[model samples]
Target chain A: MIFDTQRAIAWINRIAELVRADVERLTTLDTAIGDGDHGANLDRGMTAAVDALAEKEPETPGKVLITAGRGLVSKTGGASGPLYGSGFRAAGKAMRDEGDVVALSDALEAMLRAIEELGGAHHEDKTMVDAFAPAVAAFQQAAGATADMHTAAVAAAEAAEAGLAATVPLQARKGRASYLGPRSVGHEDPGAASTVLIFRALADVTAE
Target chain B: MSSSANGGPTPPSVGIVLISHSAALARAAAEMAAALAGPEVTIRPAGGTDDGSMGTSIDLIGTAVREADSGGGVLVLMDMGSSVLTAKTLLEDLDDDDAPAVRLADAPFLEGAVAAAVLASTGADLQTVAESAEQAWSMRKL
Candidate 1:
């Protein structure tokens, strides 16, 4: 599937809707190991991003993602704002017109790089990187094998879900959850859960 | 006071940006720090989300860093988590030359802010302000 500007905007809008619907669930997950504000903060940012995209009417897929990212950076409070904002912005920069599976995979890789560089979190850190890194790898693998955006996105989302689940039983080594030490075990990382939601949104939009 | 190029008293040589999740907490800390640092130091509070809810704002911190800096460098003191991440992201976005030297101090928020402010007010440089804030970590409470 060719991911165009319209598709990017649709994906963002869908993400906003999904995040709003799952705010309580996400916040509950965060309350177990984080500051319990991830859902509300991300919801607020996504809402603003949708509004910004509607107002800006960006002409290109890259512009759409960049605008949405800017909105998130300005509207969302906390570390998630900058981390997610930079990720989206980096992906946008790497994306191309009528982007194919390779392009999509490259974009996800760029997003993961930006997040990793900014957060300094690695795999098994029980942070968003846990999900994001694996999702990027899954996208690359699926794209290399099938050269299909839908297949790549679905694979990425599935990998992200597994990564998110894996966060449980691992002690957090970054962010507020790290302060809890062993107490953080058994609680899924809020950032990782949110990363899963983002990949799921990507998969859903591409499947449509 | 040292003379500026314009022949007026030189502004303080360093500034402070206090970042926190709670707007009230940041503001109160800035106020307390100001009491010790006097009126000359530039100490800006960038706290809470844009809508005044709990959480740190990157836009707010970016603006605070720009405003607090008066050619002198800015030292950022963060509470935890997102605050530090947000500040680091903001720094990365800025151009190296266009942006003033900004340092993130690893210290307790309240103590660091107060200590940094006092140092800045004395016309200390950016490194000195940041080092003073870090020195707060060694302060023993007993």
Candidate 2:
């Protein structure tokens, strides 16, 4: 089954709920390495995104994502705002109106590249790219192997989790956390943690 | 361009936008920059989220950019962190045909805004205003 507009809307709504539940956790992680606003920023952004989707009821999965992205940029109020917002818009524009498994794979990569372009974060920089890049790679590999949306989503989520875990041992090379140098090594990057949540939300929605 | 009946070749003033993470800070800086410059020049403060919290808002920045441009290009000066990213995102969205082209000035926020404002008040072009703002970094106090 294709991941249609409803599925995409469900994914964002799920992300909003997940972010709301994990706000304190995200905030704690950010506080350890960055400005301590990750949780609140994402929560507010995702919540607004969900509202936007409901109001606009975009005709296609891509339009839904673009609308959600606009909401995030307008309300997230942090670095993640533009980073994640731009990623979603790029992904949406790449997908256009299509929502096939192949489109999903391409959209994931597009989102990853957009984030990299916006934040200048690369793999192993202990930012969201750590989680996002691996997730896209995993999804692409899985989709190329099976062309199954659920399988690809699961693989992406697990890869994102592993990437998030790896960030705990890394010295941040970018973002506000980089200001801390080696002192940032012990904490998991908040951006990576949020990326994990994002993939997990996708996997959960795909499973449904 | 038609010259004013009385004034001689009066060029349109370049617009200035100040972006910061803090709402109060950006407004205060705008106030200072405007004071240094004349009141006729438009200097806008695009700061904080819509709900009055810390962090830059893309919507706010977009609106400020649109409002700042007075047929003369707008010069944007941003504080550190996401303010730069937010402004950059908006700038990327601007097309070549967009009216009153916008340029981001990579200079100190307060000092750059002050310098840019002063120069803009002189009816300088966008490039010159941007250069003046960027050059403000060299004005280090010994």
Candidate 3:
């Protein structure tokens, strides 16, 4: 249970930074079949979200995530914004009035629900859900085995990375890529890749 | 030319709309256009949610399409299927009186964006610019 206001802020910043760092790579991935702006749009949205957070830091972790979600929705101006926004919004909803510290299981469940509700994507959809669903499940499972937040975060990040890699072989069932049908088969989903970056950053911040 | 380069009258004005299945993807497209267009152009966007919610109001998008059609025409760029369908619906939603005469700028976002931006910079009216965009797309494909 490393879910404090500070940890929340760190999580937002970490995700933002990674998206910012990998914008072009993600864009290239998107160019394979879908529109080639996933990286650029996501980075832009996260940058604005971070800036908003800097201007007015929230007192609660939930508040911070909510702010991040809305900013991405308004500033990013695309499918990714709403989907990611829904993810943050869902997480925030789960944490409502839950005080400063939340169990790792709680965080995982919140995020998983957020992704599902927002993206309307499923585990095998070959979207970010592919990475997120597995990662959260792994994190939750690991949390039951260990009381260490760092360990849970690390495991979650690893699962997310593996999930992203797995997307290379899977066919996309959702999003613009889905239109291409079989053409979408080989390309790694940029959304999943960007998602992995966010989770990896979370692991970095939560790692003790 | 030199004086204008140092202190030009002002740049042309452009509006942007990003259409995608996910609001995040639309936002990403708008963000890129903003970077390329600089601070001067007004960028507008409409997108769907992760769950496939329409990104912008159909009425509002109709207005943008109409507005673009006012003089030259409107350039509509679409990302995916529903976006195209929604854009189509937006056009169809318009009453004859409410509708703005427009052209669908059929091009990849990157090329269409550049075309739109350049046309705007040159002060081409929306219809003319949109026509130019469509033409550009046609030529590029050829």
Candidate 4:
């Protein structure tokens, strides 16, 4: 349950793989309400992040994610680059500060804070916060109960999935989808879906 | 890049960066701003993602903000959506000690860029330029 440099690297690699596999679906979802480049953009960013991680070989778990975040910021071609990149960077910094299950919750909290602060997201905005906020809350509850990292991560991942599903019935209030107004309802939000992928990646790595 | 620091002709007192989702749109806006404001003003057109897509790239905007900063400051005007979000991130990351101060103008992109550029070319300070740019919010198309 301890996040090491290896585990952090594994998490990122897993995310990249998942994004590549889900690109078509992500793109389709985005095309419904967004600019239609979410999947390809994230795929390209995550691929470059993996390459950057390999080249950097950061010494600590925190540095690994931080370096990957910097790669995301530099390489990604959309808002998610900076939004998710900044979130990861903040989470990595929190991880560096604390190394226990509590740190995992704190890191997720930091990621949520970064995303909300940067994106100005409120709950039910049908943005990444939809998934990220619930994920953090679930992880925090587990971590507060002194649950193991795997358990907390699993809870977080499941919450993220539920949040993603919840987005389907909501109208977009921010980002490109907001322009669609009421038409944005009934479609899964691309950002929230990607956020689910992030939590799933974390849970998978932690479980392993 | 302080115009007053030297005995030479004054440079623009402030710099401007125009951020848009379209590269051509940013370039054209900057071009028109320059045509009206003259060449002395530091204006950078940071448009499109790094991969030549219709989105904002934080890296591109960061570069433009840094490159455009004279000793005065940089005023950033962005189009909607990612451009605004991305610029706000860079704004948060910026430190006044390390770089010039930055102001994000919430105004119409083209109008704000032109207005800010014109004011900057006149040796106005950062606050004045930002205000000029934001004034475009009330600009009437009719």
DockQ, model 1, C-alpha based: 0.77
Models 1 onward score TM values of 0.93, 0.95, 0.61, 0.94
Residue A2 in candidate 2 has what lDDT?
A: 81
Off by over 4 Å in 2: B1-6, B96-99
Ranking by TM-score: 2, 4, 1, 3
Mind giving the per-residue lDDT tens digits that candidate 4 earns over A106-145?
8779989998998888999998899999999999998878
**Of 1 and 4, which scores higher on TM-score?**
4
Number of colliding residue pairs in model 1: 0
- lDDT by residue for model 2 over B41-121, one digit each (tens)? 899998898878889988888888889877888999999989988988887778768656889999999999999999998
- The number of the candidate with the highest TM-score is 2
Candidate 3: misplaced stretches above 4 Å? A96-104, B1-142
Residue A100 miss distance in model 1 (angstroms): 1.6
lDDT value, residue B83 of candidate 4: 80
Look at candidate 1 and tell me the lDDT of residue A103.
75
Q: Quote the true-contact fraction of every model.
A: 0.92, 0.84, 0.05, 0.62
Write one digit per residue (lDDT tens) for candidate 4, span B1-142.
3445567767547888989989888889999999999988988999998878787788889999889886788999888877887788788778767877899998888889899988898888888999999898898989
Identify the superior model by lDDT, candidate 1 or candidate 3.
Answer: 1
Better-scoring candidate (lDDT), 1 or 2: 2
Regarding DockQ, does 2 or 4 come out ahead?
A: 2
Question: What order do you get sorting by DockQ, best first?
Answer: 2, 1, 4, 3
What value does the interface RMSD of model 1 take?
1.2
Chain A only: TM-score per candidate: 0.97, 0.98, 0.93, 0.97
Candidate 1 local lDDT, residue B63:
88
